[model samples]
Target: MDRFARIDTLINNARIFISRPSNRDTEGDVTAVLGVNIAGHITQLAAAHDRGGR
Candidate 1:
């Protein structure tokens, strides 16, 4: 904040879809879903701050 001192725009398009309980626990499913759905967004948001936002 002190560096750039402002922000203009921010976008987080991470998403996940699980229609069944079995699908949620399958191999690679949890990592894929959580990685794209949550981890990715958190990473991008953190980058925004470090890079002066946008």
Candidate 2:
């Protein structure tokens, strides 16, 4: 912010996929993916919006 003065654009490209098969995936693994792939992006977007990013 100090260097750029203001945020103009936000490009979200973060994701998480379970490497193993669904049958082999544990509850913790599924939870972690959901937390990062969904909640994490939402949190980031909220932050960017607060900073005036488009």
**Which number leads on lDDT?**
2
> Model 2, residue 45: displacement in angstroms?
6.0
Worst 10 residues of 2 by lDDT: 5-14
Worst 10 residues of 1 by lDDT: 1-10
* Clash pairs for candidate 1: 9-54
RMSD vs true structure, all candidates: 5.8, 5.2
* Model 1 C-alpha lDDT per residue in residues 1-54, reported as the tens digit of each score: 568765555567768887887734887888788788877666666676767664
lDDT of 1: 0.71
Each prediction's whole-model lDDT (CA) = 0.71, 0.74
lDDT per residue (tens digit) for residues 1-54 in model 2: 568765566666767887777999888998888877887666576576676784
Return model 1's CA RMSD, one decimal: 5.8
Those runs of model 2 whose alpha carbons end farther than 4 Å from true positions after fitting are 1-13, 40-54
Residue pairs in clash, model 2? none
TM-score of 2: 0.46
